[model samples]
Target: MNHFTICASKNDTHDIEEGILDTLAQGFVVEKNDSSYLLKSKGLFKRHQGAIHVIADNTDPDYFAKNMPGMMSFYHNIPFEDEQLKELVMIQISVFNTVIAVEMDKEITDEQMQLLIKLLSSIGGVGFLPDGTLLDQQGLVIVYPNGESGPSNFRPHACTKMINVQEATSAQGEARKNNTIAFLVEKGIPYVASLPQLPSVEDCAFKRQEDIAKRAVALLIAIQFACDVAQSGNIEDSREFFLNMLHKYNVQQFLTDNEKSFLQAQYPDAQYPDAQEAVSIAWQYEAYWTLIWALGFVETLEFPDDVCDCDYAIQVVSSCETFEQFYAQIAMRSKEEILDEADKIYRLHWACVNSRINGQAAPLALNESVVMERRRALFWMIGYRNEQWDTMSMDT
Candidate 1:
C-alpha cells in the first residue's frame, strides 16, 4: 500500500472536508536513511498535501533541514551564542589565504563563499554577502558594499582585519609579520636570530617559550620550599641562613605580595590555583630562557610508594603511586617525601626532564603504560604546564 485515506477534521459534517484535515494531520513519515523529515506518501491526497504545506524545505534554503526545529527543540530550545566562533572564522580564513597564497591565484568557489557567510552569521555582526560583499553589524553598507547582482569586489583577506577592531588593517598586517618573526626566533631557541641564545624546549618557538615558562615556575616553587625549610629553624641555622640567601638572590623581584604571604603563612597545606601560579612561573620562565642557555639534567623513575616493601606492584600503590619512588631508584635515596621536598627531588627530577629532552633518559622496568604513568607523575613534579594557543601570536 503506497498511501491511505483519513478524515481531515472531526467537526466538519462534510465527508470530503473531514478526510482532507485528517490526511494533512497524518502527514508523511521519512525513512531513517534518507536523513529527511516526513516519509511523504504518494496517492490520492498527494496533490492536496503539497498545496496546503506551510513548512516546505524549498521556502528557505538558509534553514538547515537535517534537524528540523521540532527535533532540535527536544535537545534544547535555545539558539547559538559566543564570540570565539568569530575568531575561529578568522583563523579559518588565515588557513585558507595561506593555502591560496602558496597554491597560486586560486579563488574560493561559490560554495566556499556561502559557507563563509553561514559561519560568519553564526558568529553574529558583520558578514559577507552571497557575492563577497561585506555587511556591517546593522546589516547595512560597510567597506565593501553589496548590490542586487552580487558583491562589488572579492577581498577575503580583508575579513581578517574586520574582527580585530583594535588595530587598523595595516597595523594588523604589520603585527602578523612581526609575529611570524617572533615565532621563528622562539624556534631557534637560545638565540634571537644569530645572537642572544634562548634556553627553551626543543620544538616550535611557542613550545620552547612554554617549556621555559614551566621550568621557571618549577624553580620558583622549589625556592619557596627552601624558604619554608629555613623558616622552620629545625634543619639548621646554617641551612635556614643559606636558603634565605638564595631566596634574596633568585626570587625576590618575581615574588608578588600574595605569593610572599602564601610562603609565610600557608607553606605546605596551601592550595594554589593554576593561572595565578602561572604568573610567577612566567616571570622565572622569561629569565631562565633568556639568561641560561645551558640547562642541567633531571631524572625520575616513578614507582609505587610501597615498591620498597615488595618486589611486585603493591595494591596500595595502585591508589597512591608517587614519583618519589623513581627518584629514589636513581638517586640512591632510600626515603620518600612529598612534593614540598622539591629541593631534594630536583637533582633527580631535573635529570629526568633534561634526559628526556636530550633523549638520554632510558626506559627502566616498566612498559609503555608504566612509562606514561611516570611521565604524568614527573609532569607535576617538574611543574609541567601547557601553553594557551590563543595567547601566542600566529604567523600571519
Candidate 2:
C-alpha cells in the first residue's frame, strides 16, 4: 500500500472536491499509470505531468520532467479554506525531498537564495520535519539542536532505544552503546557514529543541498504570497507578515543579511532598485546561484575560497547537461564518501588547476566568457528540473 491515502476528513473532502474541479478548469486531468496517479496539465508550451502521491497524509503533485533521475518537486493548488496549511505542507515536503530550484517568472532575491542554502546546510543530511524537527530513516525522532522543548515532545518517546550514561569507559565505546540506528547522537554534545559501525553526528552534505533547494522554493512561495498580499493594498501588513515569516520559519538563520537588504530596498528614501528589474534579475539569478551551489556538492565536498571565482565556477558546473549528471561526475564514492559521483568528475576535470595549488601541475587555460556560458547552461538545466524549460523549448 502507498504511504498516504486519498481519503480526507469530512470537512476536507468538500475542499478536495472543489480543488479537483478548479484543477480541471485549469486543464488538469487525472489518469492512472500502472499503480501510480498522473495529473496532466496540457498547455501551449508543454504538457505538464504531475505524478500525484499522498505523503504524510497529504496529496501533492510529485513532479518530474520528461527526463530526470531524482524527483524535483511536489506541487498542490490550495483551496481558500486552508491555504496556509497547504503552503506549509508543500514547504515541508520540498524540504524533505531535497529539490533544486531554477529561475522562472517568480520574484526571489539572490540574498534570499543564499539564506536557503544556509538553512538546508544547517540540517546537514537529514531534512527537517514540518515543525523543524529532525527524523531518521525509520521515522525515529532525533534531537534538534536549535529546537524548542515541546509539551507534545515526540523526541523522548521515539528515543526509547537511546542509551546515555556519564562516566563511560571510552568516547567511541559510548557511541557504540546506543541501541538505535542513527548517524549521530548526542550524549552531552553530539557524537557521530564511526563509519558503518558507529553513530554519526553530522549530516551528509549532498543531502543538505537538497534541503537548501527545498527551502529556497518555500521562500519563493512566501514571496509570492507577500506580493499577492501587497497587491491587495496591504503593503505594510504584507511586509510585516513576511518579516515575521522569516523570523519564524527560517530555522537555519539564513535571512539576517537578506532581511536587512530587503528592508533597505523597501524604504522610501532607500536607494530601492526598480521592483520589476529586481524581480527579473532574481528569478534567473537565483537559478544560476543554485547551479553553482550544487557544484560545491553542499555537504559532500568543500572547495577552497579561490575556487569560487565566477568564471572557474561556471566552468566546473557547465560541463554536465543535468544537475544529476553534474553530481554523478563530481561525487566521491568510498566507504565514507562525502561527494556525489558527478562532483568527482568535475574535480578530476579541474585536477590540473587544483594540482598547481597542491604543487603538482600547472592550471588549465580556460576562457572567462565560455565558462559563464556554461553556467547559463546550468540555469537552463535547473529550469528543466522545474518543468519550466518548456516556456521556450517546447509546445504541448
TM-score of each: 0.23, 0.21
TM-score for candidate 1? 0.23
For model 2, the local distance difference test gives 0.32
Candidate 2 wrongly placed segments (more than 4 Å) = 1-214, 221-234, 256-259, 263-266, 269-273, 280-396
**Least accurate 10 contiguous residues by lDDT in model 1:** 96-105
Clashes of each: 22, 29
lDDT of 2 by residue, 1-396 (tens): 111112111212223334333443345465644433455555555444444332221233233222111111111311223344334333333223222222222232343233323423332223233334444323333333343222222211111111221111344434433432232122121211211122222222233444433343334434343344334434455556655544443422432244345433454542333455335323433333334455343342222222234344334434544435544554322312212222222222233233333344333343222332223323233332232221322100
lDDT of each: 0.28, 0.32
Report residue 199 deviation for candidate 1 (angstroms).
22
Q: Model 2 has how many clashing residue pairs? A: 29
